[model samples]
Structure formats: C-alpha cells, structure tokens
Target: MPQGISTLAADTPTLSAANTGFMLICSALVMIMTPGLAFFYGGMVRVKSTLNMLMMSFISLGIVTILWVVYGFSLAFGTDKGSIIGWSSDYVGLSGIGITQLWDGYTIPVYVFAVFQLMFAIITPALISGALADRVKFTAWALFIALWVTVVYFPVAHWVWGAGGWLFELGVIDFAGGTAVHINAGAAALGVILVIGKRIGFKKDPMRPHSLPLVMLGAGLLWFGWFGFNAGSWLGNDDGVGAVMFVNTQVATAAAMLAWLAYEKIRHGAFTTLGAASGAVAGLVAITPSGGAVSPLGAIAVGAIAGVLCAMAVGLKFRFGYDDSLDVVGVHLVGGVVGSLLVGFFATGGVQSDVKGLLYGGGLDQLGKQAIGVGAVLAYSLVVSALLAFVLDKTIGMRVEEDVEVSGIDQDEHAETAYDFSGAGGGAGSRKAAPAPGDSVAPAAKTKKVDA
Candidate 1:
C-alpha cells in the first residue's frame, strides 16, 4: 500500500477504539440518570409512593435493555422508509450493525455504539413516567413502556438518528438527544398526564417527600454521570473533548442551581430541596443538546435560563389543571427547548464535519433551521404519543383498578414493598400502619391508615 493509505489505516483503529470507549462510558452515565430521575421525582411525591417511584425508574433498567437488544435498535438505526420508521433487515439483535458501521470518523465497535445509544433510549421514556407515578398499575406501566418504545421512541429515534432520517438529511444537530430524548419524553409526559389525570388529593394534601437524602443522592449521581454524557457526545477521546464539554457541564449546572434557588427564594419565600433537585436536572437537560456546540459562557446562560424557566413553568400545571405528577413536562420539555433554541445563537465555530450557528456569525439561518427541526420533532412526538396512549388505554387499559391505586402499587402490582419496617425492625423510612384517631383497640378497620 502507499505510505499515505498505510498511515491512514494504522491511525483509524486507534481512533475507533477510543470512540467506542467514550460512548460506552457515556451510555453508562446516561443509565445512571434513571436512578437520578427516580430520586428527583421521588422527593417531590408524597411518601406513600416513594418506593413505587424508585421502582418505576429501576424497572426501565430491565425492560429497555432487553428491547434494545431485540428489535429496538433495528427499528431505530436501520434503513428508513418514508422518513418515519426503520427497516427490519438489520433485525434480530443488532445483526448487521456490528458487522459494518453507520457513523464515520470513529472506530468503535458497532455493538458498543448500539448499547451506548440504547441506554439513552432506555431512560428517555422512563423519565416521563414520573408524571404518572403513584397511580398507574405496574403491569400497565410495563405494557405502556413496551408499546410506547416500539411506536413512539423507535420511530422518533430513527427520524433523528438513522441514516436516511429526515432530520439528519436536513442538517439538524441533536448532538445528544435534545429533540429525540428530552423534548420527546417531555411532550409524551404531557400526553400521559392528560390521559392518566392527576394524583389523588393533588394540591389539597401536603404530599411531602419521605426522604430528602435520597433526593440529594440522586442528584449527586446525575452530576457525576453527566461528564460521560457531555464528553461522550464527541464520539471519541479526541483532544478537544475534555475542555469543551467538561466546563460546559460544570458551569451550566452551577448556573442552573443558583437560578433555581433564586427563583424559589423569590416565589416561595425559601430555598427548597425539591427546587434544587429540579433545577439541576433542568440545567442538565438544557445543556444536553448544546454542550458540544456551545461555549462555557453559552452553557451557563442556557443552564440559568432553563433552570428559571422550568421553575416558573411548574406553576403552569396548577394553572392549567394538568397533574403532570412530577413536572416532567415542566423541566425536560421546557429545558430541552431552551437548549435547542439557544444553540442557534450560541453555537461556536469548529466542532463538526460541517455546520455553524449564530455565534460563529452564521446568523439566525442556523436558528431558523433549528426552529423548524424542533417543530417537526415536537409535532411528531405529540401526535404519535397520544395515539399510542389511546391504543393502550383501549386495549389493556391505562390505569389500575381504583382500589389498587388507593391501596398502593408496591404491594398490589409488584407484590413487594420498597421498605419493610416490620421486617427490618424500624428502618428510617419503613412502612407501617398508624392507629385510627378514635380507636382504642382497632375500633374501626377503615379508620386506620398507613404512614407514608
């Protein structure tokens, strides 16, 4: 071979491995967000459903992992038809993907790429279910996720990420799923909340969280894992990866946290734990799409704006009478929009095979493209998600029996409790029934209620 070709071949393998390694780590980081979501939502809900909320997030770890290996990947990254769904020729467990490759400029194994992307796929829908927490049957949720992934997530993923995807062809830059994951999940959450309705005694009850510590722990894990999320988007361990994403992640989250607290202090008269957790997540969601494209300063602005906007948008649920049980729509949907649109203005020069945004003096031309892209994704996700929910409701039914919901899903659906106070002999957050106010010796069976 010529010296030039020989050198190119020698260099390619090293780059490929690095890309694969980066993506694998990034996938794991994204996976960690599921638990983060569990805690973030867990802390906002009443104590009765805390474990149930955690379980909901945990279950995705199992369900999505399996589906991705089966046909989820093929349905997403395979050949496209009608710019909607993917072909099945690459089906039966990532058959053709690992043999050849779709993405260029990186040498990672295709399976590595699939699994990494798979983690993002797994967690996105799971993030939305927080809005339906504490009420829906576990069985119903499982079925919903299975069906939703096939119908909603896979097609949207294809439209954004697949080879012939319309968005890809249009030169829209998702970088890391602002459109595909966060915005899509947020919109879907809105639809599910509309279908499922609000939690019982939503505003009337105090509905305080059972554990603040768990909320903090979840946030910590999310922050730690985000390094992988932002850096890994580079698709390789190349030289610019560290400086570009690391600062973007750090500053954006910090700006978001401060903005959230500031908003809380102004609106509610104090800084709240729930606000802190929610703000961090909002910052993370906002930065997700813009991280690779924007400068650190731009990220801070994006994070701060997302944090405050989401904090304010939470009030919309109450005003509109939508439950959105845990504000998935408020944070992710709103935050994703903030990031996506801002990238149009703030995206810097020199970070892609091609394309530049407003900051590179490319003007609003890029922003206009971004706006169109966002509209397309939003419209498609909303319509498809509503249809999927409609079908599931008519078929297996969307909710649990009213009795089961009143009783609790942990015992009813899973046949397991998140905590066993009696079994464990008094752990901090154990489940136990409290005596009725009028009872001397269990006077009225119905009067006694369990501690949340």
Candidate 2:
C-alpha cells in the first residue's frame, strides 16, 4: 500500500520508535477500510440483499488475513527472482522474521510492514465485491478470493512494489496502490461480472439504493482512513514526503467530489448523494498513485479529471450492457488509470525522487512506464479473474437460482435478512417460535418475518 522501494536511504540504518508507532497507526487505519467499503457497498444494494453485500466485503478481512500470514507477504515482498516474483525462506511462515529486525532498513519492524501490507491485500479484493452485488453465492465468492489473491494479487504486488520487481525497476512511481490495489481490483470486478452476467432485473428493476445515509457514512470513513493509506505509504514522515502526501490526498478527494457534483448537475440536472459518495471515492483512487509525487495543484487536476471521467465511465455499463452493480469498474479502474498516467504530466520531481514529469522538464519516459504498469495489471487481473469465476460457476455455480435472486438472495444464501419487516404490534403476523418436529402450524397462518 505504501510506495515500493529498491534501496535504502544513504543515512544510517538505525531504527526509530516514532516511525514504528506511526506505521502501526497507519496499518490500523488501512485495516478499517474493509468495513468502510462494506458499508458503502451494502447501502447501494436493495434492502433484501444488504447482509450479503456487507458480508461479501467483511469476509475478505478474514480470508486475506489468514492467507497473508501463511504466504501472501512472502510471495509479494520476499527475495526477488527473475523480476517476476519473490521468495524467501525467512518470509515463509513469518516465524523466521525477527521481531526486532527493521524492514529493509526502515525504522518499522518487518512485522509492522508485513501487517500494514496485509491490510492492503485484504481491502483490494473487498473492493471488487461492490460490482458483484446481490446474486453471487458467498461460498463461491470466498473461494474465488483465495484463488484470485494467490494467483493474481500476490504476483502483481511483486511486480509493482517488491524489491527489484519489473515495474519497480522500470521506475514506475506508485506512491500507494494505484496499480496494485485499485486497477487490480477494478479489472477483476469487470472480468467476474462479465462471466456472471447481470442481476435478475438489470435495466428494468427499481434497484435504487436503500440507504443514502449509510453510503455517506461509509464514504466519510474511507476519506478519513485514506489519510493513513496514502500518507503512510512513505513508511515514516522523517523526510516530510508523508506530510505532502497527506495534504494531496485531502485536496484531491475534495476536488473530485465537487467535480462529480458539478458534472451531475449539468448532465443529470440533480446533485444526488450517490454521486457525491462515488465522486469522493474517485478522487481518492486517482490521488493514491500520484500523491507523493504531485503538488496540491496537480492533485486538484487529477481529482477533477478523475471525477468527471469516472462519472461518465459509470454510464458505459448501461450502454454496453454489462452489470457492474455498483460502478467499481468505472470508478476504481478509470481513477487508477487517471492517477497513474497523470504522474507523468504532473510529477514535480521534488517529492520522491529527482525524476521530473513532462510539465517539470522530464520527457515522456515516466508516462511509458506508467502505461506499461497499468496495462500489465489490467490484463493479468481481468483474464485471471474471468477464468476463476468461470471455473467456479461451471463447477459450483456462481449465481443463485433465478427465483431466489429475484425474490431475495439473503434468505437463500445466508438464511438471514437484513431487516425484519413484520410489524412489532404483537399481531398474528408476528414471528412464533419454530414448531417442534411433531407439531404443525395452521395452514392459513401467515409466515412471520424474523432475523435468524
């Protein structure tokens, strides 16, 4: 989630307690993002499917954490091999890594770095859940996550941020996870949705969001946690780079929200709460990759462009006839691209390195690197995710039954509903205790609604 590095600074390698403490806080912030995302996506779906939507994201916190402890960190950040992947015996079970040893000479311990990155790994898959809302089976989704992260996310993280990885060697500056997280997850979402197809009533049904307030709450939490996600990418703030990233993150997110609302007013003639939430997310995504290298002005430009572009991109699903239930493809994929590519034009050459963007007298070199990084992650994620979903669909079935989906997926999948609509007036419709095996209910009695 932080910027990738190949070498240590020339100063002494002594550790700092302050840096270690700062990183731990950042790691916690990043960890909160998964629940934040759950709420955001949960609020977008119909009332009947709210629990499923939330569970889709919340599950990643468990699945990815276990996998990361097992081998995820090693595959992503261990010793280099042929510039394609990484491995180290010490990183295998994390038992070999000493608690006192600093990570690659940074002030934070290896455990802190590994856990911080673990948060990134966890949330990346969670981001994809937004696009597959309402229909997919939870067990299949969990299996897909385990396979996808091992096959796709781990290697891509190596390529983008591991020491001596190809994209890292190419000098593609990903301040945070523009390529490894956003683009990777967004592309995966697109691929899986393509395989699974649309919801029961894609274009015809009234699938309006059930809770705008919850969506807004989630968006606010994401914005707050992102300060840590972006700023902590530097690992420590001794050099003041982290401070700049923090400011840029705020600036870009604000700009993107305003820009999205403006575009909405002109095009749709209304400034909706959904648009505001989506716009803020777009700005956050766009600034993630370029924040450490760009100025506040550049961040504004990045946010505005991403807000407008993503707003327009969301509409493409309707025209092209893909589902993309919550616009993950439109927002994260497009915003990641805008931020990653814009670094070539907006980079000031003073933040992270001496390299300059075109606006700062550098040539088109960085732009080419950014493009390669984007294309590589996009292609790998899309193809692999599609294949994974297809295989699972063929073997275990990804989508629920048509009638189950049309009525409600939560009852069939989770045996639970998000809300209990049966009145609390103690009427006949109120839920009664389940009858014993030998007992029977009256045939004319109405089925009472109760959350199991």
Top model number, lDDT? 2
lDDT of 1 by residue, 123-162 (tens): 8878878789778877778877887888888888887777
Candidate 2 clashing pairs, residues 3+ apart or interchain: 2-233
Off by over 4 Å in 2: 1-10, 423-452
Error of 1 at 62 (Å): 2.0
RMSD over all Cα atoms, model 1:
6.6
RMSD of candidate 2 to true structure, Å: 4.8
